[model samples]
Target: MHKRLSELAFGESGTVRYILASRHELNCLGVRVGKHLTMITRQPIKGPVVVAVDGMEVAMGLETAGCVSVEVD
Candidate 1:
């Protein structure tokens, strides 16, 4: 199933399908389409969401995470 990255539960993993905004910035952070990502951490109260991509972990704001579409494994 495809869902917003921010909607992923902890430890859930998926491949990126698309991004609704900040493509350039997200790409620079290794979050481009087709990349596999795992939800590492999601802070409470509208905090940032951390995702693991490649061998690195990238944290993005909730709004940004909500813009990322991922195909769940």
Candidate 2:
């Protein structure tokens, strides 16, 4: 299944298949579909978990929990 990168859980890993953000935002972030990512853990020592994209870390919001669609290997 395909899902947004923002919906994955901590320790959850998956490849980005697509992003529905605005074109301007997409270009600014340099993110695109098919990018592989892995959720490391929540950040701020109490905030949302962190995800890795090409070695870069990104944090996910708690409200958007069901945004990413991942496939387990």
Residue 24 in model 2: lDDT: 46
lDDT of each: 0.96, 0.54
Model 1 spans > 4 angstroms off:
none
lDDT of 2: 0.54
> Model 1, range 1-73, lDDT digits (tens) per residue?
9999999999999999999988998999999999999999999999999999998999999999999999999
Model 2 residue 41 lDDT score:
71
Residues 1-73, model 2: lDDT tens digits: 5544444556667765544445344434444556677877755534664667788876556333234444432
The alpha-carbon deviation from the true structure for residue 47 of candidate 2, after best TM-score superposition, in angstroms, is 5.9
Itemize residue pairs with steric clashes in candidate 2. Answer: 3-69, 7-68, 16-34, 41-49, 42-48, 42-49
